[model samples]
Target: MKTLVNTLMMRVIEYFASKDMSQITHTLCVHEYTRLIALREGYKTRKVLLLELAALLHDIGCPRSKELYGNCLPVNQERIGAEIVSEWMPAYGKLAPKEIDWLVKVVGTHHQLPMAKEYGFEALFEADLIVNLMEGYYPKEKAALYEKNMVRTASGKALFELFFHHGKMDIKSD
Candidate 1:
């Protein structure tokens, strides 16, 4: 299952191979970090894999958004990515419509607050923030505190705290 997921993810990367490679790297890191956090929380293996898939393709709409409007705003990006992923439902095999819906929503709003109570989206969102904090993209103090409080699962919090204090990425001085 894990190998299948990685293969799927790599295929996604290749499909978008003409796009910004950094975003793909960032997406994978977010998925990986989120998986680490979710695993510690005892989330089912299936759920964790779903979240990883969601994380990897969440930004899938960015290139379109960039070409159309020069931005990757949460709503716009998610909607676009969702539509794209939805088209793949036939090839994806066995995924229910609801699952696709959730994937769309997760990919769409990762930049905004988590709108669902389900821990899956929240975990994915927090993991992305963890990576962003490392990138020095979010304001340090707030990002630090967000890292501290927003995590819902045991592993989520632990991974966040580690990145909060020791992440390798630093803010580039403007």
Candidate 2:
């Protein structure tokens, strides 16, 4: 499993590296935050790996979106990303069919706050949002609202507070 994951990681890194350096950086940052939140939440290794993969590929459609629409809006990205993951992962990563389906669902609904918990993508969602916040994609003032509405895992809330609020926001634990 580790070897397969390593191979897939390398493929993903190469894919993004060839396309856009900044996107690769964003993907890596989201993956790191996903790792931290998943580990801190006591998730087993397999689940963490799945979440990490989702994180790495969350924005996979951005380049295609730009090509098609001239802008990578979240809606367009999610749609194109799901298609790309559905087609690409099986050929390149050899993930289980069910795992591929889950990945498709996750990539499809990444920006839809309500589907995160429903699709078991809480970690991926929070991690992506955290990286977006750091990248100034979201206004800093809205961090608390995100915490209250979208964040669910204790680890996610804690990390959000630490990064966006300087560890000072009194976010109630999930």
Candidate 3:
């Protein structure tokens, strides 16, 4: 079952392979990081699967935005990506409509409008932040601020501290 889930997710990701190679790699990185963070935080099978899928498709609109506007604007990508996910989910993952909607919401809002206390959201947000940090896509100076303000889950906070803050601060599990 797990293999089936993962394979389908990978196929969905590869569906856009011709768009932008870097974006695909970025999604893959986010997917792996999301998986790691979710496991570390003791997320169960269903939640982990959802988070991973969200991570994989979080920026699915990047290529479209780049092609249209020559840049990846967050708002544009979010809107476009949600539409893309809506069409792809049913065909690729066999996800129910509600689950597909949930995935779309998480992927669309991950950048600017995340609500508090949501484990899947926090995991995907933190995973993308960590990858963006390492890839130099985002400014390092702002990571500390975002970590302080945005990260909610213990594992997410711990990973942020370890990567951006060098593990100087002690991490406690909730």
Candidate 4:
């Protein structure tokens, strides 16, 4: 399973690299953040693998989004990413039907905030948020707001503060 996951990850990275090297960096950062949070949160091996796969593929729709919409807004990315994963995963023969369904949901809803948590995507959400914040995708005020609202796990919150807040704000967990 691990080897298969690694192979898929490399394939996805290659795909991202061909389109945009920056996106490959973003994907790797998000994947690392997801791994840290999931492991700290005590996710089992299978769950961690799922999270990693989702993290790698979360922005899979960006190229198509740019081509079709001339922008990669979350809405377009979500829709196209879900479609891409749904169409592409079966050919890889790596994931079961249920796993593919969950991956589709995670990729599809990764930008939908609390709703994504319902699909067991909280870690992916946080991971993506952290990377985006670091990359200055959000304004400072908006980043702070997102940190307060979206970061749920201890590991994620800690990373957010360390990277964004610089250990200044005393964030209380819900």
lDDT (10s digit) by residue, model 1, range 82-147: 788777644767567787777777766667665634435777777787788778878777855785
What's the lDDT for candidate 4? Answer: 0.86
Q: Please report, in order, the local distance difference test score of every candidate based on alpha carbons.
A: 0.72, 0.86, 0.78, 0.86
Model 2: how far residue 8 lies from native, Å? 2.3
Segments of candidate 4 deviating more than 4 angstroms = 168-174
TM-score of each: 0.84, 0.91, 0.86, 0.91
Q: Which stretches of candidate 3 lie over 4 Å from their true place?
A: 116-120, 168-174
lDDT by residue (tens digit), candidate 3, 1-174: 366467756775676677777777788888888887788888888888888778878898888888888888888898888888887788765567888888888867778634424424778888888898889988898998888887777877877887888875454455
lDDT of 4 by residue, 30-56 (tens): 999898888888889999999988998
lDDT of 1: 0.72
**CA displacement after TM-score superposition, residue 146 of candidate 1 (Å):** 1.5
lDDT, residue 102, model 2: 94
Clashing pairs in 4: none
Error of 2 at 82 (Å): 0.9
The ten-residue window of minimal lDDT in model 3 covers 112-121
